[model samples]
Target: MNKSPGFILTQLGLDKDKVEKLVKALDPKTLQIAITDDFGSSFVLSTLSANIASIVETNVVLQHEKDGDLGNGWLETNYAGSRAFVLRSWKPNESDVLEANLTFWRGAPSIKRVVIRHVPEPATQRLLLEKGDVDMARNLSADQIAGLAGNKDTVVESSPKAEVYYDGLNQKHERLRNPKVRQALRWLVDYQGTTESFLEGRFKVHQAFWPSGFAGSSTETPFRLDVAKAKALLAEASYPNGFEVSLDASNFYPSIDVAQSVQATMAQSGIEVNIVPGEQKQVITKYRVRNHPMVFLYRSADYLDPHSNADTFTRNPDNSDKAKSRPLAWRNGREIPQFTEKTDAAARERDPAKRLQMYLELQKIVQENSPFVIVFQVQDQPARRANVKGFVTGPFADQIFYLLVQKRGSRDRGLAQPGSPILAGPDPGIRAVACDAPRASDPRHPRAHFLRAARGRLRDRPGGTDRPRPRDRG
Candidate 1:
């Protein structure tokens, strides 16, 4: 039973001798991980700790109760995964940016001194990038992207994301427990109208939890606003007069707007929705641990695989007390034993073709019964200063390949000639690249030179050749 020394050492605060002895004495059941989506790729899924997994899988409340204050917090970094950057300090900075200083190790990029300034507000981020303060602005709204068009000093790049924003109904609630009532609610939502009008064509309507283009994605809008059908289902569920329920959501822009839209549309079918607004964290706490009657939240895959999502919504335990993760359907006491069996079997399947079929089958089964009102898949939009060369972002927010980004002439090329593209490249045009390895560096001479290069030359000089960066690099 090989265990991760890094994880164990940090968690227990024990000496090597004591830790090894404790690990050897533990029972096998106490060290088992419920889900292991370790399919070989750049991405893989597995619990950081076997001991913690055994507890949290059975009691979801334990995770939420701690929420990072306790040692068992889900996101508490045990140790650095890669030695490319040793996180020295992280704290809230001016203008709402979360500043994190990363000390360089060997095999790191040439521009080694790195400080990740995380700016959450898109508008503030855009202003900073344009004024030559910050070099990059991420997840720009469609409006911001439109505003940057034809600007010689900046470039807008985008990629399809694996994230989904959906509405979850708690089956534990009397009115929501009935399958027909659940189905009735799905039909009452105007998924198409919300995505098209409110989202401004930035999102794609999804039929299930999985996003489109994935192996199991249905990409089918099975439910639509049909007042008559919704009414009939409510009648069947003994809710002819419809019922009143509270929906909790964050003040975040599109989410609050979506909840309000659902509130208005559901009223047509006699379902009265009371929209409760709160901060994002407060809303999340209410929905996940308290099991709010209705919740509008977003979920994104940790890895680019169908099992990453399917297994979570399906493998719910019959005894809710033993449920490892809170499945949307289980919140309302809805049961589909077959759904659990099928999804678990599929997750364990080795053959690619067979796995794909299993995921598709799972989607169909969930859509026909579950308490999930699947909404839309979002797209990522990031804008960078034209001078910032080689920056790339992937489908997920954390999929940043910052090591490849190099400033022009950081190593060899001289100041680009007048009118030449200032790194808005179809290519960042360089002859040879450095090795991709991280080694220990002298702390005193930490390459602080990179920061100066990052803010240089916003526009092309005379005789400059402009080449736009490829959209597919990330």
Candidate 2:
């Protein structure tokens, strides 16, 4: 298993000897694994359920082996699981057609076929949805969503995603290294203003690393656009006249708008923010190397556990350039040894309540003092035909499932009143036409079909530009 190029032993947080002793295959269908560390049950269990741990058909994988290693062809070219839908056809940068898996163990999905079309333009998606050419539109701007307010033919569903948008103050910059400066920057953000304006219906004011709808999430938005307070803090930090710094941001919708809004607000406190707009990859690449003065970016959890975010946002185990694990804290050149210790302790707390408290405490510390000024949490708002029933959108893109989705006839479409819940109980045998954002280059699981569709449409752009779109993981 370790011969694969994608294999990473460090991801398990164990050395070779420990891994050999802890993992064993007892039978063809059963694998026994044990963690020697005092990790929380929730954290450990969550890791086991993550996409990386998904079981694959060993024989099918071995069939595509090359150079004594299993290649990545299974990710997109082969199907091995008994999922509800199987990829019938996939056209790059275009669409995917999934046929129902009749032999699925859980029972065949009521919908016979699921067709996902890649429609990048929100207006085109909206027009198609409105014309009944498509049953669902996964990408729509806040204004577009607002325009459909009273449309009885459609229902808008909003799900709070785990992604959080924040501004990272590069500690490599002398002015941004000060705690008071970090706090000052926090006060300079017009959270409500942005949330109500360009960010409306898409993001909500959030101040912590852990997003809401999770166990350890903090709902306290303590800092607002307090220019006077920010100025006082900056003055106390020996910068009577705020220092000039470059703020790198993705040159895209909402990000550019957000950067401009932040630029305007920071000016009120004497902080001269020179907006450096670039492609999302350019901005992220610069931030990843700790080369930016400040960066506006977003991060999503790899898994559902609180530590998924805490580990990245708070912990910086190594500060040197040679460090192998460089999370968000390292990306901003922030050394947080104390918070890292607390985060480790939180991850080890097996008691659910104690672990929750530990995470909460950690969040409070980061919220008040860290270089990261977490501003907002994403809210996914997808508009679907009023008759589209049983469609589900979860906190993460991978969690979205269309197994039970059904497209009722036009006669039944009028049965749904305006603003009524669109996600209803399942009715048998109907086809669904879903318009999604873009497509992920490497799709991992069969269930990830709709996820890739939703994720592609929401997170990335076509033609491999790497520009930041409206939503999804970092």
Candidate 3:
């Protein structure tokens, strides 16, 4: 089975026979895999590592289950996984309902039901959140976020997303092909000014491809708005008069604003920039084909690994238009052989500390030289009613989990009162079992007591009381 051409061994560039011999099924619940190559650690962090790591949920079906392009309809008709919630109903462009998974392995979710409504208008979303008709409002503009400041009933939660916004200078353009010109464009970006104004609270100045808060991320901001320096570099690149170029940007907030800012700054150094704004899809379609001279865009990592961003931003194995592997570097027509070699080596490094150091060095090299001018990392700000608690939004939007989320009031009142059940529903029988299990102060809380006992801090006395055990002073 491992030797079959359809197997993933070919994709990983591994010897199928070796891998097959190293993997064995010991029992129904136990499978062992031995890694013989340095690529093992990095591969484990990727989405292709395991079924659970895949972006799509892993489902158990008959040997020969559904076939032929299911496309987007797969999730609509099928149910899978042992998640806290199960899809109850879905209506295209309208709303979706998620019912609590009563038989979930962990426990039934606190919320009995979750209804997600599609309200595209930010104003409408704000109104619904303020009126207590909705528990949370996800898509809101900078102005809308500020407007909700005085709403005591609603509180905004902010989290730093792993998405980074940047300007990709296409090497296909003759003028942009110069390394000095590319470096000069970096200085033209007013990172401080942009983040301070329209992009305030929404984005932070992040110069590196790998976003901050990651293990090997670099928070270095070397380039600023230096017009004289940019002009000198343009002169060195044999473009003393500064050449004219077209920039493709999405006709929406932030992208258009950033493009206009770039345009204004580039003009200071005698560069003429013509802004061509189009719909998001149209702009991205052009960008993907390397048809744009320059593009203003944002990218989020596919997985939580330093190699994720490094591979996309630095490694371009093939610069040809027909290249099978097209990452961000390929799309920008950048042929970075040195960066590619370093990125691959970093991914394969066995030691955690050494791998992290390699990534930090790679980020510095890309930050100073690459055609991509990484500007800001996005901050997701979602407003929710005060009654809603334990709502978690991870670095990625898809990482949002509602397992522990709870409403602290009666269903009809929409107001939280002290001593109310964590979640309220019409059927009191379906109340959260975990909530009624134990209090933190109760001696019977097994988890708390076990944790303390594990640290040798707590011991049971003869009278059934927990007392702190004496430390071993010796």
Q: Which digits, one per residue and each the tens of the lDDT, describe model 2 over residues 1-474? A: 343211222345545557667777797557788766677787787666544434555555566777765534444544444566666555554565665665555777777566667666777778877877677887688888888889999999888998899999888888898988998999999999889978889899999999999888889999899999999999999998888989999975578899999999999888889999998888888887889998898887767778888889889999999998889999989888888998898888889888988888888988988888999999888798877888886676556577888766422111111111111212111111112211223253334454555567677734433222323211
- Point to the candidate with the largest lDDT: 2
Count residue pairs with overlapping backbones in model 2: 3
TM-scores for all candidates: the values are 0.67, 0.82, 0.78
Ranked by TM-score, the better of candidates 1 and 2 is 2
Return the candidate ranking by lDDT, descending.
2, 3, 1
- Count of clashes, each model: 23, 3, 0
lDDT of each: 0.58, 0.73, 0.71
For model 2, the stretches where C-alpha displacement exceeds 4 angstroms are 1-31, 410-474
Q: Of 2 and 3, which scores higher on TM-score?
A: 2
Listing every candidate in turn, what is its Cα RMSD in Å to the true structure after a full C-alpha superposition?
11.3, 10.4, 12.7
Off by over 4 Å in 1: 1-89, 93-115, 118-120, 150-152, 235-241, 321-325, 387-389, 406-474
Please provide, for model 3 over 278-394, each residue's C-alpha lDDT reduced to its tens digit, 9 standing for 90 to 100: 988899899999999999998887566788788889899999989998889999999989889998888788787888889899889889888899999998887888888887867
